[model samples]
Target: MKRPTPADACEVSTMGKMEKVPTGIPGFDEAIGGGFTPGTVVLVAGNPGSGKTTFAAKFVYEGAKRFGEPGVYISLHEPREEFYMYMKDLGMDFRELEERRVFKYIELLPPLGTESIDVLADKLVKAVVSLNAKRVVIDSITPFIRELGEAKARTLIRNVLKTISKGLGAVTLLIAELPYGAQVIGLGIEEFMVDAVVVLYQRRGKAWTIPVRYLEIRKMRGRPVEQVVYQFVIGPPEGFTVLNPVPLEVRANVDYRELLKTYISELDEVLGGGLYRGSVTLLQGHVGTGKTLLSLIIAAENAMRGKKVLYISFEEPTEQLQQTLETLSYPVDKLRPYLQILFVDPKSITPSAIVSKFVRRDTLPDLVIFDGISSIRRVIGRELYVHTIRDLCKILKAYGITTIFTTDEKPGKDPAVSAIADNIIWLRFRKVKRGLVRTLMVLKNKLRWSDPIEYLLYFSDRKLHLRKLEV
Candidate 1:
């Protein structure tokens, strides 16, 4: 073949510099600015069982299968047959790939005495060139270094990288084994020779809880990595995949901002014109003090306004709530279209169940009323109840859904619910000459410009009367 001229050589180098060698692992390529640079040597360093081999295999397999670039996988410890069967188990189908001449698996054992390191390096380069391979993976170089000493091993690796970069121009992955507690990476010197270094580690989370697999890009030549540490999982049928980072803010997909009316003028007036969208209101009162009644009234009024409402009852059964609404003269027939009633036995409900139902509902509601959180707090332990209530409020608020939670007041107030609630309303009944007199008190209102005060609560002729504002 005739040697190319200076202009042709410049064009070729420019093209090679512009292109990237993408790894098939999801989120990995994006972390390294689309992929590895062409003709670059990448060192994947990890402890035993840290998914080093699986990652290298997936990298080459994806190149062959998706990018139409042939690859060679050279192993020193893993046998050729075992490597084939193992990759097959992971759905790589390396046998078929080999048959199609897209993949080549080679195993070279240690004690390479008779043959010189330069000769072996030449043989590997020839294999890549002969097969027209564009990608290569060696799992790994530790055993080879053990057989050829550090100095000779370093020289041999430099020659191999030169052969691939200058002769074949193939992107290569060199796996390096590090001891469990080794401070240095991959014989310590290879880091300087390679263009990139990635470490797979088992990182313990939250007070040394069980470890999770994580990938850290320690160095990437000429590329900037946004997130250094990324969570990854190695499972069969997909091989190795890097997981995306968790979202910083949980945003609602549908952005609804209008407040659903509670239909109580004075109550709504004290609540900054109306209850704000995505606000959680806690209704606390003793038995017969109208906590449940207030929740039902809000739900009924919101539903009557053509807004979808989900009413969850822990105390009253669905039939009993319907009958009570009928006795209270609420238009149950008109409200049925816009309301969904779910009667859950508090003992049978768990935090997970409530979160799933609220987050994954088929028809998401504009407003939700959890009538009788006291029962939930009692059934689920206090700690679990607090956690679940907090999570539920977060999900509801994130989804822009107005929430009403009713709980019976105890002698000493529990700050658990109030801490997460955006609005707090307290109901109390005082005995007087005219039977029992009910009063409503506003303890907290997160809405802008809302007056927090107490008022006499009187209900008659399907309307609520807030009279004699005090305190």
Candidate 2:
């Protein structure tokens, strides 16, 4: 190659600065300084469904379509057919690209807990050199590490990233799935070796409350990226789409006082005139503890009073809910004229996805009740259960929606329930010295104080009524 003149060198440098590639992922290219700089390494880490593979495919797809840059996808976990199966639903044509000699797909068979990292590195290098790849993706960095063992794997990861950058001269997209809630910046030797890191997380909430989806990215090479979290989702036509953040005003400051007033007059007075506008009240008790009945009373009464309300009943089916409420003297028909009830059956939708899709943009209800928060929670898993509740509270409070949640407790034991709810409404049936009786107690109210401490509530004549406790 001949050395260029000063003018030619200047032109080359300017063009290099102007050259940009779309990563095929939404919000990702923008996060990585217009696109990966030539020979830069980007580490993308997430739990499953975090779009690790799909994101890499997007990068390859955009390289071909936008820059006419040939790319390669190396798979260690699955074969080429498997890659196609996962990407096909997302409108990817990897097989066609392979046939056209524009893109190459390679799969390596590495044992999960017993693979040699040095051998792995050799395979990676050979693939890059042969393809003359301009862009590259490693579908997963997991199996390689698992096979090589922990300490040795770290060394291999570092060397692979360093060698790839120096010899291949390609922008690298390394796919990784870390355990839940792990830090994004450091992953063995690879963390320190990468130029940028992005962590994607999914949050959830009770009933119609929408969980805002976003990601956190840490730039190691001074990439132009905003620190603010941005909403994202995996949808059709566009695989990963990013949405604008919800305006602060639209998400918070509810009126609990009005909500309490809207309920039965005595219940309102018992609750010190009203619950705050934007507050979360949890109904806690054991099975058959009147959780559904209490929700029915609130939903039916509010609906009857011309207030918009949404009821997501997890334990009871729609018809089953109607029949049970009818048996308890709360008929949906009698209350139909006063209020509107929208049932979000959990059988079809996950609680977290519901909040992201429905709670944020749908009807701004005066009250929203997630009958039995435990049902939605069972799907979130044990590790993330606490954080899930906290995020839910934030989203609901921002929307200013008077929210209520139900927790079915075990008999005679209060197991860390207060940590999750803003207000704890404990409903119990206990045998006192006098006799066996039902009890409803307002235990913890985050917004304000209440005086009526305990009240005797009744379900009679197809209606829920209240009376002062006979002590």
Candidate 3:
């Protein structure tokens, strides 16, 4: 399956006769459905350290640097020298633009004892016209209007922003600072006043390990938006990057017989000559039904055949897995060349964390084996657990990787893992007249017709043996 990029999934309607202006920021244009309308007033509001300043600066710098449009950055809180160094650290050379006369900086200090809203608006409008600036950013409108009260502040933004936006035909970004944990964005009137309102904040991702920055398009007037909450990251080179959810389309190409050859002949026969390539096989039974041993057998065989295999065990350590394989008469040293064993503590594992680690690997394996997957269910919730398993299966199968997962389930009780598995091999211990006996049964097989017969399974010569029961 090919994953759809942000460019492919976000297709906004171009029916309206609105002239769109590109933000020059990657993945941001898609959020606003192909950028903002020209000469629009946008409010970038958020708490301190929520990337409000950087967001506004990036827009300004991008417009002046890449889009051939001069911009004005009005600083009310930070010094010009400090702001120059800050933007430079973020890989934006604002000093160069200023030298070329393509960018301007307006500094309006506080103590506006009698300066009315109209006065500030007049200064901003003059700056834009003097520089012929197409883009303008007010570093912050919070302190500037705090003394005016919410009612007066609302009037100031409503009057001032409309004047600048319409007077000079410039796209303006007003930076607003809301107190931490504030319920509303700005004075709650900014959303109504501005043509677009975007809020930036930090949210704990699915894992809750690190706080992820998110940009929310609360309101984009007169434009169709595809996403509301977008995950973003601010770092060097590219100041901001959005982690968009790409839709996956899976297409499988496999030879069922060739895939099944990775297993021993005994297990392969019961699996309709071989397991289907790209099929998720689940081995379910009680604790001591040789589930780990079986999963290792399949992994070890494939590794010895020069196929790459990745084995992940949540229950045991890597040393323990290696010692056990050695004790089982398998050549652990030779097998190490093609196999990689990873032991993840189920207590500390998250679906997003683990999946990200897997996909980001330099190379992918031909087979993925998960032993003791039942522990994952105990750590992650049912919904997330199922989602993790299905996501891994789909991603691996899309690359033609065979998957085998093991779990311990009670009799007649279908576990959630069964839903994602394409084949289910149930092993259990039964008490017969001859004492305790181990048997293998097929609960489901998508490849071919499987007879409902319990086969006798035993260990002989340090290898697994499977055969039909004598009548």
Cα-based lDDT at residue 175, candidate 2: 81
- For model 1, state the Cα shift of residue 139 in Å: 0.6
Identify the runs in model 2 with alpha carbons over 4 angstroms from their true place: 1-51, 57-194, 197-219, 223-252, 256-262, 272-274, 303-319, 325-366, 374-387, 410-422, 430-437, 444-449
Q: Scored by CA lDDT, what does every candidate get?
A: 0.75, 0.64, 0.76
Model 3, which residues run further than 4 Å from truth? 1-181, 193-216, 226-260, 306-308, 318-340, 345-365, 387-401, 415-417, 432-438, 456-465, 469-471
Q: Considering lDDT, where higher is better, how would the candidates rank from best to worst?
A: 3, 1, 2
Ranking by TM-score: 3, 1, 2
Worst 10 residues of 3 by lDDT: 3-12
Q: Candidate 1's residue-wise lDDT over 1-471, tens digit each?
A: 121111110111223347776777755775676777678888899988898999999888988888888999888788988988888888788888899999898877664662556655765777788789888887887777767776877786786665566467688888988889998975578888888889998754332223568899988888666755777766665677675443337553222346567889878777766777778888888888888778888888788789899999988899888887888787788788898888987665445446656543446688899999888777656786887788787677766788889889552377776887778888998666767689888888765545556689987777787876443
The numbered model that scores best in TM-score is 3
Q: How far is candidate 3 from the true structure (C-alpha RMSD, Å)?
A: 6.9
Better of 1 and 2 by lDDT: 1
The regions of model 1 sitting more than 4 angstroms off are 1-17, 88-91, 114-119, 204-210, 246-254, 257-471
Q: Quickly count the clashes in candidate 1.
A: 0
lDDT of 2 at 35: 61
Clash pairs for candidate 1: none
Model 1 residue 291 CA deviation (Å) reads: 19
Quote the positional error of residue 180 for candidate 3 in Å: 6.5
Q: Would you estimate the TM-scores of all the predictions?
A: 0.55, 0.53, 0.62
